[model samples]
Target chain A: MRNQHQNGTNHQVRHYQALSPAQINRFGLVELGSSGPLYRFCVRLFGILALLGIVGFMMRVASSGFSDRAAWGYYVATVVFIFVTFQAAPTVAFAIRAAKGHWRRPVSRIAELFAVVGVLNLILLLPVLFLIPPITGGRKTFWFELHWLLPFSAPGFFLFFGMLALVVCGLCLLYLSALPDFAAARDAKGGIYTGLARGWVGSQRQWKMLKSGLNLLGAFYLMTFVLVTTLFAWDVSETLVPGWKDAIYPAFHSITGLQGAIASTILALGIARKFGGLKNHLHMEQFWGLSKPLLATSLLWFYMGWSTFLTYWYGRTLAEQHVLQLLMFGPYFTVFVMSFLLKFLIPLLFLIWNRVRMSIMGPVLIALSILTGDIFEMVRLYVGPFTITEVGHEMTHVPAAHLPDFADILIIAGAISGAIFIYLVSSKIIPRISLWDMKEGMLLTRVQSFHRAEVLVIGKPE
Target chain B: MVDKSILGLFKDPDSTADAVDSLRKAGFGNHTFDILSGVPYPEGTFGEHGPGHKLFVFPLIGAICGFSVALLLTLGTQVSFPMVQGGKPLIAIPPMMVIMYEGTMLGAILFTVLGVLFESRLPRPGVGLYDTRITEGFIGLLVSCPEEKIGAAEQALRGAGAEDIKTESASGGGR
Candidate 1:
């Protein structure tokens, strides 16, 4: 004997009932937190700060009149700056992954904002193109600038614009690929974010359009970043060391850039998680997941740095050997020690400790350490030669100049900060997270009897 | 540290046989405590605790060798063929020192990596009492007890939320 209930007990509830109830969308899931007033405020603050900094830099440059530091300082800063072009791809990869990772849920929006701004800042790099004129202007500084290739007309303009086009193209594609996310942000609220998201709507047609375009653009950007960054590294950085040239320099720059990107994202996430009330949906599980990349890359960065040195030591070239010497004990020893401690030692120790890596403090500390080492890497490349003090001086060698003054650092700091400011503001209007992705995750989740007698979530493919 | 005896809470079936042994000795092996984690931490050599690790020294050796080599190649080589430039000596050692500095750091970090791999017992084909479920987030505890204590141990395991008690035995790597 079977018992049937009016509401279909132990069966489908109200089969073929009137379809009058408001349809609850299980698929459309977006993060609950809104940037609110803080989003707009931060954007405005960053723009104000950046403009102020640029103005200050102009004032300093006017007062100083090319009296910043020695030739070595200029050379090193230029080398590191140029090498950054190669790093762009890896940096983008890092930013994307960090933003997408689950642990980054708390402050993922801010990270996306941070990355977009970083991409835009590449435009500000237009001024760096100015460096070419002085070198290629047929003017000699201690030695006539090497014109191994172009002996007739100045090719500086051509080289600069050609590289600029490639970078701009790559950046444009990357930005376009992020459009769907921006659309999601735009629809989030009626204020700033919605304004940025402007035309993006969550429709099948729109998604298809975004996915196809993004896939095509992502591949182009990836390839372009690889090619252009390598070219930039070779032409700009390696030559600064006189005889110090390595096949790995291009790869090294790229990998370091990736490391930098990873670190930057981690730092941004840390800042967001704390300042923004993000701990609710963003759980501890997410933090560990994001950490795995940082750990893996830190090791890779470690490997890249080591292999370059190992090969140089073995090859024993006059130029290579001297370049190594200038870094080790000659003039850059203190900086070397600092880099070692920050880059390898501290990170290794922290990563090995499971407790530390799992903790909130780990990401912050490691990011700071990497930043310090990054600065040191630049100094070693350019500063060591100039800063070396001749100990047993019997007229055998000349003492190079000291490290770069506060003025040079200030310039870079200001420029980078300005770039960061732009990112902060843009994010207020942009949907930093991919709404389509969030909705997809929602669709794949279901409540089920996970075991014999317990309820748990079963993840299904969308 | 949590005692291996409480492994019941962590849920190991083989420990049941051991619990019987403990029961015969008039002991329930209540020294057992549960591991707070999402994966099982297996136990080995019932009477003897596994060896504790010391990785601190590995990086030290690496750092020493690294700095030492960095000094020799850059500074030492400069003495050998110091390229004299702009009225400088034949062995212009300072510029070469830059290479040494980067080299030293590189060497130390490489050694540190080698040291970490060595200390962690990593890349094991098959390692101590493990269940794939642990990776998917299950905290297993390995209990040690005498045979006679089996019933109480099983009850205790269930009371502490043992998903299931499994007989965990180590199989050699090749197996």
Candidate 2:
């Protein structure tokens, strides 16, 4: 839609024609049903990789039994990497939706779709749970001596249940958010969508309930995400390393998760816009809007990391030094550098620019950088600690960084690919764009002439 | 004097709002009619009464139940065992707080989901006086009325530019 210049001014105003509700519903349903050859090929490719991940996992398990925690360093790192990145992606949906950012309407579904990956991560977490020794082994753990009294292993027990709660909540959030779209498909085609929709009729009461449910679930999902992150950080990484008791570490891990979540969401949005036939729906506004948070999280990542590093640096004791060497300067120095630059330094330097932050590719590129850094960061955090087998209250020695082998590489690539594979399959079932959200956005927004330029007027209802 | 359900479809929101206003003017109370749309127009867009819900109560109740159960499990287990590990008391409040927190959240989340389902009256046996076009940008104003007032309801709906009207018996099939 275009508006002509009429007041003897040479300024041309461009008006956006929002997609009608019917068009949104029809297009979303059609897109869900029909996948291009390229999309199908990608899905198959990822499916093969996912199978390879299973093969890699089995190879590792067979070759090096669960007794050797050192050998499974990369394995645990890969699982945590997935947990913090793809599994954390839904947090962006909850955060943006809770903040009532209208630009998030198109992006929220992209973020929420990543919840399906939580199932895969939950399965990956089980073996890692077994890998963690009980808290009774004279190791310093949050559980103290609870392992002696409890029937099961304390760390593993808590980690498994915490992760399970997060996964279930995430799935519920995704399901509830997609209910309206299912009803749309049911209205259009009347097959399995009917059952999935479960008799949703868009009545006022249903809408009210749906809205309330989303808000509550989103809040719960966010809290559970933080709790789960804390569990992973403390039990898997912190408690594993003797004398590595930094209170800020769990918060640091959460910051990493939040950063990784935004990065993954941005990357997925870019891919969807570029290759997933969503060019018309996702615009530069979404990218620019997300870039602000990406920049903020980058700064927060540096802040948290620096705070932890500073504490260890100032302590200057042998125990603190060993802890620092294990995580930062000792064997995984290269990984720490790479993670620092990509996750914090590089994003900070580039995303600070107005020109870079305003473009579609800029934020996407930064997101890519952050995700690459997340892999290195996870390795540095999880693998280094896994190498230390000492169960004392203080570090006796800082072990060398355990490099990943062929199986570990497969596990890493396969895990990431498996997540993508699950996402692709899910996108087929659920409409990629939130159809109802788009329609509601269209209803709330109007483009009108403000002076010489056409500006959008958005309605914010209480 | 049987009750009948009537659904008046409107292409645009303004007409839907006008239909609501017209129904009220023609002796139909707010409780007798409801608006359905593909999009969630903000409450009161049609000047209809906002329905109250008990959704918030579910989470509160869940939190209380979860906290109570967690307190019992944590305190009961510790006191039953009664071993001081790190120069601490038999019942450690700090460590138990984690489990308690998890229990509280889990309870709240599960009950909130159930609350949504219950309050929404999901999985209804039948969708009465419904039109599929309502999901395709059309708005439906559904009215439940006595058989004697069907003509007046139809007149009010038509006066406000209803695109189409469908009526169904109280027992539930739309035609």
Candidate 3:
């Protein structure tokens, strides 16, 4: 009825209200200083838990230096940190943008903010560096010992530079994507926003540049992410364990990282919707849209995991048998089941239900389940390889089951809590939603009547 | 004599489209005016979309650069200090290929983004000819006319269904 003003040519004068910058500024971001009692409580709780975990990590490091048990605990914590924070969180942004999915707008910023966590990972990697045994005789690592020609390719230098580049690239991409919003914010609040909004005049040229920058940076980040994860898997997991050789394991590890990233993105979205006051901006549509990818990744997780198992299963050699015992049937058997079932089986079953896939709660729950499974999966992957104290071409004995000690528990708690704390802090600096992208979506979308139902039509740029 | 700039707001896209047509008929060239709206109506909805097919070339150039870098990293490093393993050749193709492919893609993507920014001249700080209402579902048509044709421009816009009109000096102050 509001659009009933027909022109002489019979075109309807649609009365759509565009949100002003003021309106957008009000709802586009959650106030960094303001919070509900629940949010305050959660932050405080996570903070205390994170401190305890950090204290526990210090104790573990002080008490057990290069000892097998200490190494196991460190490896456990490292895997958890990589999966939860660094690898998965930033990935959702790149994956969605590269695919050209319009629904990516809301959650992309949330994903990009995890770029800072890469710094935390670089710091956490220090202990792992100290523990890498001297590469002598039969221990062939992916890295060549050309310490003179390629000094940076050394494990420590390589990870540091790689992670540094990743963080820088991520920040650049984030800045470029949000340049318009920064300009909008700048016009309103001319302090820090002015500096950040440099060169954004909204000229036709700038818009083209922003679009191109996002696409290119996003592609570069995705490829780099896979390569980085592969390097981590190869150096830390495969090379450290004697007589362990699996070509597909590194690739499998990277795929799992992607699944974890999708899960982390979903979880973050659910939380923001509930508490960060993003309910209107983040809709069920985003959840449903993202669920399809989650499902595909879940299937891929199983396929990769099975491929590793099948290779070992079919070979049935003594060395291959030892790998099975260490990773699957030996001390890690329970964890293997959890990773296989929770990560793969249950997720596969629950996601198969259309009702579950369509709702926000269903995917969030599935994401949590998968995250839990990821923890177990990391433990299985790391603990097995770490407990092997001997280095030989032929593994005469499979490592026995090694349970997590108190240190492992503390470190794990600390790592996870630390991830939450970092995410919360980053949310303050980077808006939870890509405000400019949201505005773009608002401009492009219109409700049209379709026989019996009103369908939303999104205009695509030519 | 200074030129005059006139901006008119239309309540609907049809009226705005009509005004664009009228302004063109009045001898205001396509490049002399701009249409701003909250929605990106299809290109040519107003007239021709802004220039360039140069964006497509960025990825090709990037891929070539990336491939070159990968070749140098993989081959150059091995040649300088050969770390032969398991009787494999000094130049391993499979592992090198992966690095090369990733590098190529990275180059293509980065360059593509740069090309867009270069073409757009983005991050340009300062305002231009714009209206806040343009983002609020109002289609605004901005035009530059000679001092003598100011009346004719006003008449054309009003006849084409402009809801509101404003005229400003064709100086930097208009933005």
DockQ of each: 0.01, 0.70, 0.28
lDDT of each: 0.45, 0.87, 0.69
* Residue A212 lDDT, candidate 3, scale 0-100: 63
lDDT of 2 by residue, B1-175 (tens): 7788888999988888899899998999988998888899999888889988999999888878877877887788777767565566777788788888888888888888889999988876556678899899999999989988989999999999999988885424641
Q: Whose DockQ is greatest here?
A: 2
Q: What is every candidate's alpha-carbon RMSD to the true fold?
A: 21.1, 2.4, 5.3
Which candidate achieves the best lDDT against the true structure? 2
* lDDT for each residue of candidate 1 in A321-422, tens digit (9 for 90 to 100): 666767655567787778777866777778777786776678677877877686776676555443332222111332343655455555555555566675
Residues forming the 10-long window of minimal summed lDDT in candidate 1 chain A:
A19-28
Number of residue pairs clashing in candidate 3, backbone atoms closer than 3 angstroms, sequence gap of 3 or more or interchain: 15
Worst 10 residues of 3 chain A by lDDT: A4-13
lDDT of 1 by residue, B1-175 (tens): 2222333323333443343344334444334322322211223312213334444465456556755775665455445544334554544455334334334434443443344334433223332333323212233444454544545665655654567654333222111
Please state the CAPRI-style docking class of candidate 3: acceptable
Candidate 1 ranges with C-alpha deviation above 4 Å: A1-52, A63-112, A118-120, A132-201, A315-318, A382-401, A452-462, B1-175
Superposed by TM-score, candidate 3 places the C-alpha of residue B3 at a distance from the truth, in angstroms, of 10
lDDT of 2 by residue, A404-461 (tens): 9989988988988999999999999999889999899989987676776566778999
lDDT of 3 by residue, B109-170 (tens): 66776676667654455445555455444667777768788787788889999998877744
Q: Could you tell me every candidate's TM-score relative to the true structure?
A: 0.55, 0.96, 0.83
